[model samples]
Target: MSRYEEAKLNYEKMGVDVEGALTLCAATPISIHCWQGDDVRGFDQKDGRAGDGIQTTGDYPGRAGSFEELKADFLKAASLIPGKKRINLHASYAVFPEGEWADRDKTAYRYFIPWVEFAREHGFGIDFNPTCFSHPMVKNGLTLSSPDEAVRRFWIDHCIACRQVAQRMGEALGDKVLNNIWVPDGMKDVPADRMGPRLRLKAALDEIFAENCPNVIDSVESKVFGIGLESYTVGSGEFFMAYASQHPGVYHLLDNGHYHPTELVSDKIPTLLCYFDVLPLHVTRPVRWDSDHVVLFDDELREMMTEIVRCGGLQKVLIGLDFFDASINRVAAWVVGTRNAQKALLWALLQPHEALKALQDSADFTEKMVRMEEAKTLPFGDIWREYCRREGVSADESWFEDVKAYEREVLSRRGT
Candidate 1:
């Protein structure tokens, strides 16, 4: 018998439906971040620099130099990946006509109409984030919770404008646009008055989320800390979780890299599933600190996906990728990270969850351990290859050749 046929038979014997896993995984959409190609250097800035708390390491050559270049690179990377996909865009990536410009607060939907056109043509959903960092107005490392009313108002207006832009994008694309808000408002050292900033932040969020937009899914993201902002983060997990819990139609987003080093998002998924009807995730790899590393088919990723599938919230949760690594080939990074995420999900889906649950519930720990150990050695590679073949993407490392060719033919020509 053929290898795939043998693998399929083996999986069936274990009560795992191989075909079902492939079908479900193919329909799962992962939101790919746009900032990866340019190392978080958005098109809005001519200086090509991020904010105080924001930093992109390494000087990788052939970074996308323009909106057109970024789109082209994204398309190439997307082509190599399998299953359903969506584009996650930051407001800083907004494009404008020649000789025209708009600051963060003054940004209009017109600047992002090209993104909508792109999404429509490509048959991809779009998600958005308000660019809260990399701006001059974020004085003293505070925004949305700034003591300066002018600074706070600027960011508030910016977020409000971003929501409108997202609303228009969703209307244009015929899908709800997840508009996530993550502000870099924190202090370099311990702060004397945390309550004042948090109170102000709560008020700012109240104002930003005051109006309801039909096409936008609002999400608030919290960070434990950032590069320069180490001691205190104004938007802590407790604050946003409480706020999102109280507010209707707003969701609290969890970034895998946005928490303390020891905490795992895999464990938190089940907790959030209990309270939230719908959850949004920012899947990323955190090395030591919250360093945005390229994701791999690692243990944490597998555990995270396993939890999502086990909870039967596969469709209820929104999955979006968030990371930028300039140390390697940008297109290759995109393909590897996204494909690894899909692989993790597919692996989780292929598990015999019902049998495992039964074993655990009946206190058959020995049998459960044996079954789990055997599952690790199953013909998952064959199933994964079959999946890639069915999806019409390269089933192996051959796809890297295409990325290399593109680098030589297109990326290498960009001036030094």
Candidate 2:
């Protein structure tokens, strides 16, 4: 018998459906972030100023300087990745027509029509984020929560505009757009009044969501702290969790890199899924802090995906990638992170969840332990190779050769 056939039979004996797992993995769509191409430097303006709370280290060559280059890099990266995919864009990536531009608050759908066209041509759904940092309006590292009414109003208007923009994209693409909002509002040192900023933030969000757009799935992301704002963050997990609970449609986005080192998003996913109908995730690698490292097929990633699979949340959860590492080949970074994400999902799907759960319920602790350990040693790589082959992507490390060739031909031409 063929090797794959033998492996398939082995998995079936363990109550795992290899074909079903491959089918589910192929159908799952992962949202790829655009910032990774340009190092979070968007097309809205040429301010050349670094982001307030967000930062990308290293000045690796071939960072996309314009929209055309970013698009090319993103497409190259997408080509190497397997499974269904979508593009996640930030408001800062908005490109104007006829070299005309509007400030964030007055930004319109015309600026992002090209994105919709590209998505339509490539069969990709779009996700969006309102840029809340690296702007003049973010005075004192506070926006939507700033005591200054004018500053608060500007960000509020900008977020509203972004929502409308996302709503238009969703309507155009015929898929709901996940519009996420992340603010860098926090204090570097002990603040005299923590409640005030959070209260102001709450009020601003209420105003922003006053006019609801069904096509736009609004998600709020909270951070433990940022570079300068290390002491306290206004939008802590508790704050946004409560906000999402109080609101009907709004959802809380858990960025694995956004939490403290001790906190695990793997644990949080099941808890949130229990209470909410839909949960959005930004799968990323965090080293020491929210450094936005490329994801790997590591323990945390496997655990997080396993939880989603165990909870039967493949349909309920929206998965997206959030990371930018300028130190390596940009396209390769995207390929590795995204492919690893798919690997984790596929691995999770391959688990015999029903049998494992039954073993636990029946108090077959020793047998359950043995089964879990044995399943790990199964020919998972063989299954992965077949899936990648079917998906028309490189099933092994051979894909890296393509990335290197692209860099030599295309990326190298973009001189310093």
TM-score of each model, in listed order = 0.99, 0.99
Backbone clashes under 3 angstroms, per model: 0, 0
Clashing pairs in 2: none
Q: Write the per-residue lDDT of candidate 2 for residues 78-117, one digit (tens) a residue.
A: 9889999999999998888766888899878999999999
lDDT of each: 0.92, 0.92
Error of 2 at 199 (Å): 0.6
lDDT of 1 by residue, 1-416 (tens): 98999999999999998999999999999999999999898989779676556777887789998899999999999999999999999999989899998899998899998988998899899999999998889899998999999999999999999999999888888889999999999999989999999999999999999988999999999889988889999999999999999998898999999999888989989999999988899999998877889999999999999999999988888999998988899999999999999999999998988999999999999999999889888999999999999999998999999999999999899862
The residue ranges of model 1 lying beyond 4 angstroms of the native Cα positions read none
Error in Å for residue 386 of model 2? 0.4
* Pairs in clash, predicted candidate 1: none
